[model samples]
Target: MGTGPAPGRERFLAGAAEVGLQVDVVARAAAGSLAEAASLLGISPADIVKSLVVKHKDGTFLFALIPGDRQISWPKLRALVGVNKLSLPPADVALDATGYERGTITPLGSTHPWPVYADAAITGKRISMGAGAHGYSAFVDADALTAALRAVVADISDPN
Candidate 1:
């Protein structure tokens, strides 16, 4: 109702700061796709990091930080997480798990602080990712962001 940071934005800023990481929050218009969002941010689509939330059969969650031009490799992700079954939870389930809606989900300020798995391509690059809100994103040093989240970087994504 009020014009302020989104639900998890404030906490994300605090947490990033505590870890000596600087993240720049950018306001954007609602975008219908990754390419559109990239255009709005004046960056290449590859620079966008998509924080996709996935659920395991055991009821746990994980954040897959894939590049905008890629898609998660189910085999790689499952093997990395040591799970045979994983699923993309519904919007409500995702919000309940991470305290952010589907399109606005980020691992930065998640209510549950779930484990983050990032694509190796994102390392040592500047990336823009959801900032726990729709029409908003954060630009950050990939290494710092991954380190702050203690994310496991691996070849878990495929070219989309």
Candidate 2:
């Protein structure tokens, strides 16, 4: 599930439309931190989300959508995933798995539709996250995103 060519803009947009998920794609520059990025984007830190790819020992993977203001609570996520061990795969491994670089990984255009887990705190907000490419972000309603991906909504993160 972690080996394949990266998908491009075509697939990214296509996947979103296929799932009936409305997204607003915007260009962005590198920032020192999430807060700075949000500030530059004229949004709150909570609006900036991170898509974390968790690798299981069995080689399967899952997507953890965490708000910038919070972090993945390993114990909570572990329990939800019912796994004893999970890790952030190396950059190369992650790229191979989802066809997107670490900074631009998104399930919207991932090579495989790995299970997605979204933190409940973000459910009713509009959030921005990786858009399958560097220098870009995808803004979407969390509810729509969760529904589109059929994500498991839970308390998988802790305030940062």
Candidate 3:
């Protein structure tokens, strides 16, 4: 890592703090899969969450929190959002929307406070997710995180 301040990390930390959410950020080596990342972190894959940026049909976005062990259930999400269409925006659009690259995107410090949809599987567990920057993961109580962000909790995912 470079010997310098990481603005992405700073923004994420600040955002979490602003919402009174306590987060512990740890450096991580690049991993090819959720299982690999979980192994490296010594945690269950279910304890690792992926922060996915989902685009609404109306040129807006929402954050979808899916467990590493599962994938987004599009039909369920669409139903929950009361929409017929949703998509994973292109990387550039996602970066523009969240001020963080795809792999590091998290709602904690997004450029805009887009709505959040969290999978019910992660509720009440301690989970790890993107730290607003590459090579890092942030750990926090899932319940606290959702509460802090006022996320919509539902069964929005299926096994990967």
Candidate 4:
């Protein structure tokens, strides 16, 4: 760990710790995308879990964790969640709900406690994700991450 938490990494680490999940926070100069982040961290993109914020037609927000190499299947997600429609919330709404910017948002410590859905592929080992801020990341066991977030594991990712 550095002298201080980098950007939003601290929040996720704290949240993980509270739930008994061990986390290793890493800081980088500029990793704007999963590919870049992976390169800088010396890991594969598939090992990077991306946190996405989506809104239901009823205006409720939820979080989804997908592999960096994949994309969310909106249709499957809606059906799995039993929602009529789902789409990314507006930037302002996402920020308001998650208390972090789009790229840095994590399921941990959101302004509102929202349900979390994680891709089934994210299992069996350790994974990395944004720590509520950009240019920073945290590593935790995949199962532990899901457990900490109380996430529903599902095959909601598309092979994109």
Candidate 5:
């Protein structure tokens, strides 16, 4: 399933709407970094959320929503999720787990509906994240996203 084409923009927007969120779609260039993405979206690096797929030793998967200015702290995340071993899955595994490509993965409309773990700093802020497609991003209230996804918010990141 991961080898197939990823979903389109409408799917992401529709998924957000289904959860009562109205996000603004921001155009992005392919393979852009957080800085580039923020620049393109007219926001700050801290305002960009990165949607990552992580796996546990027991095969449980999670969506780690980290801010662009920070990197996920493996130790912090392990402690938060009560797991000793956690790793970022390969691109195919990520796509299979989230139904989105590497550069365009989000938890909003995932095929597996994995649990979401967001950094606490994202609370009460506006952020940009991948929108289930390449070359596009979604801008929305981080609080709304956390509420909708029932995200476990914690300090699971460190300055990049």
Candidate 6:
């Protein structure tokens, strides 16, 4: 674990352990967005899995994992989620729901166990994801990650 008392990191690690998933945390100096973080890590953005929080018209929150090199397709996501409308939640609302800020939101360690939907295009043996803290990310086997997070794989991403 990196320095600082990031509750998100704590919760994420705990969840990973609970699911018996081994993960490696890579700490960097300072990087905000997925592009910056990928650059700092010297890896392609496609290897970075970004956790996105989407809210339905009924105010229900869901998690979507998309490759950093791609973007979420709003129409496809709404249809997959069976919602009339879907939009990003406010920063504070996202943090309240996931226990992490915008730049460090992880599907794991959420305040509530929200459903996780992963893009089918993100196929790889391993991948990196935010560790519920900025400047930190976790590398884990893709299968282990999806299994641990209980993510549903779907085609909900638009190629970059």
Best by TM-score: 3
Better of 3 and 5 by lDDT: 3
Model 6 residue 132 CA deviation in Å: 1.2
Query: Model 6 off-target regions past 4 Å?
Result: 1-5
- Tally clashes: model 3: 0
| lDDT (Cα) of model 2 | 0.87
Give the higher-TM-score candidate: 4 or 6: 6
Looking at model 2, report the run of 10 residues with the lowest lDDT sum: 1-10
Report model 3's TM-score to 2 decimal places. Answer: 0.96
How many steric overlaps does candidate 2 have?
Answer: 3
lDDT of each residue in 49-97, candidate 2, tens digit only: 8999999889999999999999999999999989889999999988888
Clashing pairs in 1: none
Candidate 6 lDDT over residue span 1-160, tens digit each: 5656466788888878878889998888787567888888888899988889988688778899999999999988888888778889889999887778887888777787888899987756578888887778888887778877778888999988
lDDT on C-alpha atoms for all candidate structures: 0.88, 0.87, 0.94, 0.84, 0.86, 0.84
What candidate 2 gets wrong by more than 4 Å, as runs, is 1-7
For model 2 the local lDDT of residue 152 reads 98
Residue-wise C-alpha lDDT for candidate 1, range 1-160, written one tens digit per residue: 3665555677667667777889999889999988999999999999999999999999999999999999999999999999899999998999899888877788876888889999999998999998877778899999999898899999999999
- Candidate 4 residue 111 C-alpha distance from true site, Å: 2.0
Mark the regions of model 4 whose C-alpha exceeds 4 Å error after superposition. Answer: 1-7
Residue pairs of candidate 3 with colliding backbone atoms: none
Please provide TM-scores, in order, for all candidate models, with all chains considered together: 0.93, 0.92, 0.96, 0.91, 0.92, 0.91
Clashes of each: 0, 3, 0, 2, 0, 0
Clash pairs (backbone) in predicted model 2: 2-96, 2-97, 6-99
Lowest lDDT 10-mer window, candidate 1? 1-10
* TM-score winner between candidates 1 and 4: 1
Best by lDDT: 3
